[model samples]
Target: MSEITPELVRHLGELARIRLDDDEVTRLTGQLDAIVDNIAKVSQVATPDVVATSHPIPLENVFRPDTVGEVLTTAQALQNAPDAAGDRFRVTAILGEEQ
Candidate 1:
């Protein structure tokens, strides 16, 4: 016996606020039945002793350890700026405010 039927597909379409015509209902019924059969086949192999996993092989992090690195000083960083104000970059007011 098939697990999915045309009536069930039509009911599902109604629940999802979709209008399934007769042809769509007939096609979906067969596709859903095949999906159900595949799921059943997978369930049969998933025994208590078998472990479920997202991947077939083991995975490990490939990132290097986080550590502090050499960086430029404040004066060196602000040397190339067109304008500087007390160890900070200075820019013209952009919000139409009085400087």
Candidate 2:
């Protein structure tokens, strides 16, 4: 089992800019020790032949094919615009630019 000493916790607290009281340090020591021990057990079970994976289940792309279909004409597209220019939608100038 990995030993989480008070000195180690204090050093970590300084690096993280945290001020841990004596009680907090003592509590974290036990919690951190358990976490390290669990990780060590997992490492032992992971052999060279076993493949590493980020997820337990397999994943595949579920997207539809990208194909052109019927499209609206320029007049049809601009029919519902509040303001329309010659062949496009018109809007008030932004960024104070001249027409």
What are the RMSD figures for all models against the true structure?
Answer: 7.8, 6.6
Local distance difference test, each candidate: 0.94, 0.91
What is the lDDT, from 0 to 100, of the residue 21 in candidate 2? 99
TM-score per prediction, in order, is 0.61, 0.57
- Residue-level lDDT of model 1, residues 46-70, one tens digit each, is 9999987999989987998899999
Q: By TM-score, how accurate is candidate 2?
A: 0.57
Q: Clashing pairs in model 1?
A: none
| Residue 18 in candidate 1, Cα distance off native in Å | 0.4
Worst 10-residue lDDT window, candidate 2? 1-10
